[model samples]
Target: MANPQKPPTAASKSSALASGKLGQIIRLLQRAKGATIDDLTEVTGWQAHSVRGAISGQLRKRHGLAVSATPDASRGLVYRLPKAGGTR
Candidate 1:
């Protein structure tokens, strides 16, 4: 019988997340300006709750992303990933 496939390592998981809607969300968050729920919803065509779930459940809990949410005058709440050196 053929050997079973190896489980995905962190590198593989990250790479896998770099293509679909998950990737799109990450890209938006990685920007200097970050992104808003409206923006994420628009890009992914998902409801607000779904976007929140993906950020909270998938990115933070599952993938261990240090995503941050900050209050903004115009944007309300903005979400972003950390910069290279820090989780800012």
Candidate 2:
């Protein structure tokens, strides 16, 4: 049997936040010019509110990234990196 108390592996962590998965979502939105909560939700398979929380809380607060959304466009808003990379 596996060790229950062992920490998660790097592979697991990467999978959870892989570019192909979450990174791709962010990249697509950035490259798309912008995207709405709905667009992020569709691509990430997350709910709109969850996407909002991740954008606001996780991306903005935690990662020092920015994601914006508006009501008019099909994609909604855009995401951009800070002029200087954030505090990691």
Candidate 3:
């Protein structure tokens, strides 16, 4: 049998959006001014815990995204993307 392909390299994967739950996280970030875990769930139709994983796991761990969450004045938890660079 042929050799199995290695997983995608960091450079290639970093620019590419992760799929499934991860995709939902990226899309929410791209679309919303500041997307919380709740926003991720609303967009992806996933549970809150899963949305949290998508932000903390896929976006932060794999893609090198900088994310922060804090309670808002009215909206409960609010998420910030990239944590640096780019204008909001």
Off by over 4 Å in 2: 1-21, 70-88
lDDT of 2 by residue, 1-29 (tens): 88778798868765665455467556655
Tell me the lDDT of candidate 1: 0.93
For residue 46, what is the lDDT in candidate 3? 86
Q: Candidates ranked by lDDT, best first?
A: 1, 3, 2
Best by lDDT: 1
Tens digit per residue, CA lDDT, model 1, 17-80: 8989999999999999999999999999999999999999999999888999999998899999
Error of 2 at 14 (Å): 9.6
In model 1, which regions exceed 4 Å deviation?
Answer: 84-87
In candidate 2, the residue pairs with backbone N, CA or C atoms under 3 Å apart (3 or more residues apart, or in different chains) clash, namely: 19-24, 35-75, 35-77, 36-75
Give the per-residue Cα lDDT of candidate 2 at 56.
75
Question: What is candidate 3's CA lDDT for residue 22?
Answer: 67
The digit string of per-residue lDDT tens for model 3 on 17-80 reads 6566566576566655678766777778989887787677877896678776768888788886
RMSD of 3: 3.3
**Worst ten-residue run, lDDT, model 2?**
79-88
TM-score of 2: 0.55
Q: What's each prediction's TM-score?
A: 0.88, 0.55, 0.66
